[model samples]
Target: MAKELQKLFEDLKREMKQEFRELKESFERELRKDVRDIKASMSFINQCYEEMKASVKKVEAENEALKESISTLKEEREALYAQVKEQESRLMQNEQHSRCLNVEIKGVPR
Candidate 1:
């Protein structure tokens, strides 16, 4: 009877060890799957970040170009304004000279 009891204990120990090994294997597999999912998510986020950076760079370049164009237009406008001012001055001088040249005959009475 004692021998039989010892035999039974040994069998039970073997079975417990087998069950523990299986549980450990299942847990490891689940952990590995979670890690893979996390890696994939990180990869997608990195891709989006890179694309956004590129778009921002493009916008910055366009903005710089617009600034240059505005600066050039302002300079042209200033030059045109100067020309107009000169023309106005010439017109006023011409009118004054013409008035000076006008003569009323001494014998003419109004």
Candidate 2:
């Protein structure tokens, strides 16, 4: 009976060692998987950061283009204003010339 008890204890110890090894292996596998997941998540975050930076750059470029366009529009407006002023002066000169001709014609016999 003593020998049987010793055998049974030895078997139980072997089984427990096997179970412990299996648990250790499972824990290591899960740890490796979690590490891989973290790495993938970090990579995705980096990609998103890069994309956001590019988008910011694009927006900045657009803003600069808009500033240039606004400046050009302002210049065009000034040019148009100058043209309108010149046309107005020409019209006034033409009106004065027409009135002078009419007065001269009426002073003459017809």
Candidate 3:
């Protein structure tokens, strides 16, 4: 009976060791999968960052171009204003000369 009990205990110990090994292997596999997922996530985040950086650079360039265009338009507007003033002065002089030429004598009957 003692021999039988010793054999049963040995069998139980072997089964327990096998179960522990399986559990350890499963844990390691899950850990490796988690690491791979993390790496993939990090790579995606880096790609997004690069795209955003490029977009920012493009917008900055466009902003500078717009500023230059605005400056050119401002200069043109100033020039047009000067032209309008010169034309107005010429028209006033012509009107004054015409008025002087058409003066009437007060005693003349129509």
Candidate 4:
């Protein structure tokens, strides 16, 4: 009876060890899967960051181009204003000359 009890205890111990090993293997598999998921998420985040950086650079370049265009337009506007002033001065001079050349012949006709 003592021998039988010893055999039964040995069998129980072996079964427990097997169960523990299986549980540990399952836990390790789950941990590895979670780590892989986290890695994939990090990779996706990095990609998004890179894309955003590129987009920002593109926008900055476009902004610089727009600034240059605005500067050119301002210069053209100043030049056009100068031309308008010159034309106005010429028109005033012509009007003064015409007024000086006018004649009053009122006594000879009536």
Candidate 5:
């Protein structure tokens, strides 16, 4: 009877060991799947970051080009303003000379 009891206990221990090994294997598989998912997510985030960096560069280039265009336009406007002022001065001088000439002609008496 003692031998039978010992054999029964040994069988129970072996069964429990087998069950523990199966549980450990299942846990390892789950952990590996989770790690793979995290890696994939990290890769996707890196890709997004690269795309955003490129987009920012493109926008900055466009902004610089726009600033240059605005500067050129401002220079052209200043030149036009200067030309207009010069023409106004010349017209005023011509008008004054014409008035002086008219007065001289009248005084001379044709």
Candidate 6:
């Protein structure tokens, strides 16, 4: 009977060890899969980051070009305004000179 009990205990211990080994293998496989997924996600995120940086650079260049264009337009507008003012002043002077040359006699017959 004692020998039989020893044999049974050894058999149970072997089965338990086998189960534990299987569980360890399953855990390692799951860990490896999770690591692979994390790596893929990180790679995708990095690619997006690079693309966004390139886009920002392009937008910044465009913004600078627009600013220069606006500055040039503003300069042109000011120059045109000054020219218009000068022309108005000349017209007023000509009108005043012309009025002095006009003689109106209402009572005399033509």
Q: Write candidate 3's Cα lDDT for 13-70 as tens digits.
A: 9999999999999999999999999999999999999999999999999999999999
Model 5 C-alpha lDDT per residue in residues 1-110, reported as the tens digit of each score: 99999999999999999999999999999999999999999999999999999999999999999999999999999999999999999999999988875733355656
| Candidate 6 ranges beyond 4 A from true positions | 98-102, 108-110
**Location of the lowest summed lDDT over 10 successive residues in candidate 6:** 101-110
Backbone clashes, each candidate: 0, 0, 0, 0, 0, 0
Clash list (residue pairs), candidate 3 = none
lDDT comparing candidate 5 with the true structure: 0.96
Model 3 spans with C-alpha error above 4 angstroms: 1-17, 105-110
RMSD of each: 3.0, 3.4, 2.7, 2.7, 4.1, 2.4
Candidate 2's error at 88, in angstroms? 1.2
Model 6, position 68: C-alpha lDDT score: 100
Candidate 4 lDDT over residue span 5-49, tens digit each: 999999999999999999999999999999999999999999999
- What TM-score does candidate 2 get on C-alpha atoms? 0.74
User: Which tens-of-lDDT digit does each residue in 1-110 have in candidate 6?
Assistant: 99999999999999999999999999999999999999999999999999999999999999999999999999999999999999999999999999998998798777
Winner on TM-score (4 vs 6): 4
On lDDT, who's better, 2 or 4?
A: 4
Residue 23 in model 1: shift from native, Å?
Answer: 2.1
- Give the distance in Å from residue 20's predicted Cα in candidate 2 to where it truly belongs: 1.4
TM-score of each: 0.78, 0.74, 0.73, 0.81, 0.79, 0.77
Evaluate model 1: give its TM-score.
0.78
Positional deviation of residue 70's Cα in model 4 after best superposition, in angstroms = 0.8
lDDT of each: 0.96, 0.97, 0.97, 0.98, 0.96, 0.99
